[model samples]
Target: MLVAAAVCPCPPLLVPEVAAGAAPELDAARTACSDALSVLAAARPDRLVVIGPAEKAGRGTYPAGTPGSFRGFGADLSVRLGRADGDVVAERELPPSLAVGAWLLERVGWSHAPVEGLGVGESLAPERCVEAGREIGVRPGRIALLVMGDASACRTLKAPGYLDERAAPFDAAAGRALGAADIAALEALDAELARELKAAGRAPWQVLAGAAGNAGLSGTLLYEDAPYGVGYVVAAWS
Candidate 1:
């Protein structure tokens, strides 16, 4: 079962090199993410699974040593999910969401457990997401999750998806559900509405709810903001 979870937004801007001169804009979120990961580490889980949005559902897993780069975002920096130990494993590039997750793990020097990555499609059905989460939860040992995705991209006129009246409310509800560990609320999130509002976190958060499996974990909302008009949330459940 999921002993702990950290909910974070997946944005290339989270990487200072990608943000460049505007790096300070996300400093607080970075700090909050570090704090959230600390909680996950304290849980002492046997395994750590990073979940994020992808183009397809049930995509293959990314090994711990998978590489991620921000070169596409104009940064020449590269990161690996875990430190390279000179193993000859096949190399694969992580998706943007998992890349951010990997960056967070590196930021914290995560070493408490073996780590892996799962990519959930944005359009995946709720039941399918839950089912996938259940499978992960039933793995051989204790599991923790680092869920990455943005809430909404329509918070302001200049936002990536442009402004929408529904964006604020959608993000507000999502933030509340995450902060309270309200699994039902997360599971009940309307996929149609989420898609309309450009909320990428909907599917990933639902998966987290499924993995939690009525564990009744208490939560703490560390940070909630729309720095670039994309709703970014940081929360921890333990």
Candidate 2:
């Protein structure tokens, strides 16, 4: 069962080197992510799974040592899911979102548990996502998750998806659900609407809801903002 979970936005901008001169803009979000990770460590979980959105080519499981790079983003930096025991080569590379998750894990020098990665597609069926999460939750051992994805990419005219009237309310509801750890609300989120709003977190958040079923977790919203018009939220559940 899930002992603790952290929900964070997956923008490469979270990495200072990737953000370059704009790094200070996300300092608060970075601090909140660190705080969230501390809760997971305190839980003393036996395993840690990092889940995030991925494209068709990136979907699937990734081992602990799976490499991730930010070279495409103009930052000649690389990260791995978690340190593997000597010479454990990964089968495939991590997706962008998982790369961000790996970066966060490395930032905190994580060593409390064995780590792995799962890449969920943005267009995945809600039921399937939930089922996948259920499988993770039922596995033996104390499990922790670091979920990464953005709420919406259309909060303002400058946003990636451009300004959309529905963006704010959708993000507001998502933030509320995450902050309250309302599994039902998360599971009930309109997938079609989420697609229209370009909320990349929809599927991953739903997966979290499934993993947390009746786990009696309480949540705290550590951060919420729309820098660069993309919704970034950070929350911790324990």
- lDDT, candidate 1, 139-230, per-residue tens: 77778999999999999999999999999999999999999999999999999989998999999999998899867689999999998899
When summed lDDT is taken over every stretch of 10 residues in candidate 1, the lowest stretch is: 83-92
Model 2 is weakest, by summed lDDT over 10 consecutive residues, at: 55-64
lDDT value for model 1:
0.90
lDDT of 2 by residue, 1-238 (tens): 9999999999999999999999999999999999999999999999999999998632499888899999989999999999787776766788899999999999999999999999999998888889988989998989999999899899999999999999999999999999999999999999899999899999899999999988999999999999999999999999
> Which segments of model 1 are wrong by more than 4 Å?
83-88
Give residue 67's lDDT in candidate 2 (0 to 100): 96
In terms of TM-score, which candidate is strongest? 2
Measured with C-alpha atoms, the lDDT of residue 97 in candidate 2 is: 96
